[model samples]
Target: MKNRNLIIIMISLLTIISCENSYAEIRWEKNLATAIKKAKSKNLPIMIDIYTDWCSWCKELDKNTYSNEEVIETAKKMVSVKLNPENSEEGEEIARKYGVQGYPTILFINADGFVLENVGGYVEGEKFVPYMKNAIDKLGKINVILSSKEPSLEKLDLYMESGNETEATKIFNDLLGKKSIPDEAMPKYLLGFGLIRAQQSDYDGANSYFDRIIKEYPKSEEVYMAHYYKAVGMILSGDTDKPKKYLENLIKNSNIPNNIKTQYQTLLSYINED
Candidate 1:
């Protein structure tokens, strides 16, 4: 009986090792610099898996999502790196830079160091592939834009779409300085950046962006949305009085649609109750 039990234990250990090897098919680079260098050399993007030791979902992502054959195959087209924010100062700084709020946050960045996509939370393998494919498509578009000699504003739309705010702002400032930006595009550019700032929880910065649209392009259709988001940001930032006052003024604006007015009125009522 003892010998039989020992044989069963050996088989279980072997089975576990086999499963582990299956998960190890995709090589994960530990050093960000090395991964970036590899991606640059190969003209590929970098896929960063930002995880923590204590995160159970992160482990599930590794065992279930990353181990999927489809995911392993897709990852071959890019450099995959794992980062533990709690492990090293470099990891912590990188996580902070990318605005990582939760574990298993996947970042897809192009060779030019611009972010292509930021995927937060855990997703299954099938859902995860689309994000990777989208990032890859964006990288291709960025490369095409770089290889062209088109006007700067033509590329501005792509930059904003990819969440490359730094480049988008540079182009925006240049166009604004030269008075070359189209009137219709200004509100959109401002609104995009404002939404991005809001997503990052930088309510003050978001309000500033939204304010630009309200002040500069008051007659534009986007002005209503800009005002709405600005008020929402004020509320999010804990300025109860300002949001109420702002929403009241917005509700009074004649240009606002009846539906939007109702929406704003509802929000205002909620705040008043609060």
Candidate 2:
């Protein structure tokens, strides 16, 4: 069993080394620490391919998934690392830290060692390209937020969806201190502040933040959605009149999407009929 494990580790390492010479050209680091260094210096996210030698799916990733031209091309954009937890103490330790619950888990992480995404199972070129691009896009967006250069509604929405209050607090605090917060980030900032408050059941506070977005960033699309959520909060607080009037005004706006319009329209219908 011991020898077989060693053989597996060797095969995986050689496979990674072979990639450097391949036409597709993926430079995969065998040691994660080395990969982390490269990621930081190069300003690239780390893509860790977690697999075991015995797993058929792991082998399939090599022959099918990783072999794709598109996959190889995308891999070039990252600090690539491949490890089989059985290889060394460093490998096992890294595996546990990342919570590798199963075989063939692909971890997307930043240079700061913050985990971005954990993609399980296998993905083909068509699906894989976008899957990878999505993570990279998110990494760029997150960097902008982290750098306080730009803020993204998508990032805020993601943090809210995942219940990541800690990061949200950090982002909120970061934005609060900046003397000149860009107009691009302001709408997301207001909407995110409102969303965070709403998640905590602070309806009045949430509405205040949402109202700020409407009053200050009136031209932003966030205002339309903000009105919808604020109206929902009003209904929850048993104040039908105010929320209903707000919704009535929301539905009249042609700039908002059909869904946002329908959301307000549906809520008002329910409130009036009740």
Name the runs in model 2 displaced over 4 angstroms: 1-21, 149-274
Q: State each model's C-alpha RMSD to the native.
A: 5.2, 10.3
Q: Could you tell me how far off, in angstroms, the CA of residue 262 lies in candidate 1 after the best superposition? A: 5.9
Summarize candidate 2's per-residue lDDT along 61-142 as a digit string, tens digits. Answer: 8888887878889888888888888877766776776556787888888876566777888876557777677768778876
Q: Which candidate number would show the highest lDDT if scored against the true structure? A: 1
Candidate 1 ranges beyond 4 A from true positions: 1-24, 149-151, 161-166, 177-180, 195-205, 252-254, 258-274
- Count the clashes in each prediction: 0, 0
Error of 2 at 193 (Å): 19
Q: lDDT tens digits, residues 1-274, model 1?
A: 9999999999999999999886667788879888988999999889988989999999999888988888888898889999898987757977876778898899999866678888999998778999998888888877988787644786887677656688888888887888888888889989999987887789889989888998999888888899888888888888899889889888888878899899899889989998
Pairs of colliding residues, candidate 1 = none
Residue 160, candidate 1: Cα error in Å is: 3.5
Clashing pairs in 2: none
lDDT of 1: 0.85
lDDT of each: 0.85, 0.77
